[model samples]
Target: MKSAFAAALAGAALVLAGPALAADPTGLWQTSTRSGQVEITKCGPDLCGRLVSSEGLKADPALKDVNNANPRLRDRALKGLTILTGFSGGPDAWTGGSIYNAEDGKTYSGTLTLDGTDTLKVKGCVIVPLCKTQTWTRLR
Candidate 1:
């Protein structure tokens, strides 16, 4: 009877600890400026983030040559881009992923870390390779 009780307790403990061990970043997270939000979901063994909401800009902008020198910058779309991928660092953080900056039409390879229940630290850079991090709050 005691052995059976111990086994049941062990099973209960495992059940309680299971979800904590697994990394589930699925949620709606807001940007620092509250200018936009991204929905992060599990994509196979990896994770992918998509733009879900925007404040100051339209959903889709027209591809025009307002700034004639940069054609690629003018034609870039801010929505529906896979901003994060190949997360293989650990349970709480993601490393070796790319972040797309639609404002400049540039993609930077960087790392992401979960700071709290509603905060994500994202850092990306260009020339120096030293990332400047920003805390993104979870919206929902």
Candidate 2:
């Protein structure tokens, strides 16, 4: 009876911990700004995101990375850029990443977390507690 009860308790614990353990931030997500979509994938043990598509580029086929700070990279295309990198964390939240904003050509400290099954809260901070967050939706 003791062994059976212990097995049942372990099973219950697994079931209860399932949701918190299942935060898979992989696949493509549409940014809250509606400017583009990012494909988040596992980069070894960490997570990384790349800009897969952009509305501005879609609107104009001849679009270039004219806003980049680097003059040499100004002629590069923005569609396939890896804007987010170096993220590391668990299923609940990922931190220690940088998200590059092409508009201003600046990279900010980034943290990513799931806000349910379909929404992701992507926070970019200039400093701790001084940040801006955008809710990104999972793409089908």
lDDT of each: 0.69, 0.86
Looking at model 1, report the run of 10 residues with the lowest lDDT sum. Answer: 60-69
Q: Candidate 1 on 1-140: residue-level lDDT in tens?
A: 99999999999999988756444566888877647788888778777798766663453343232332357655545555556666556467887777776655567777778865667887776644666787888777
Worst 10 residues of 2 by lDDT: 56-65
Give per-candidate clash totals.
Answer: 0, 0
Residue 110, candidate 2: alpha-carbon lDDT: 94
Per-residue alpha-carbon lDDT of model 2 for 15-72, expressed as tens digits? 9887865588888999978468999998888888888887787887566778888889
Error of 1 at 62 (Å): 7.4
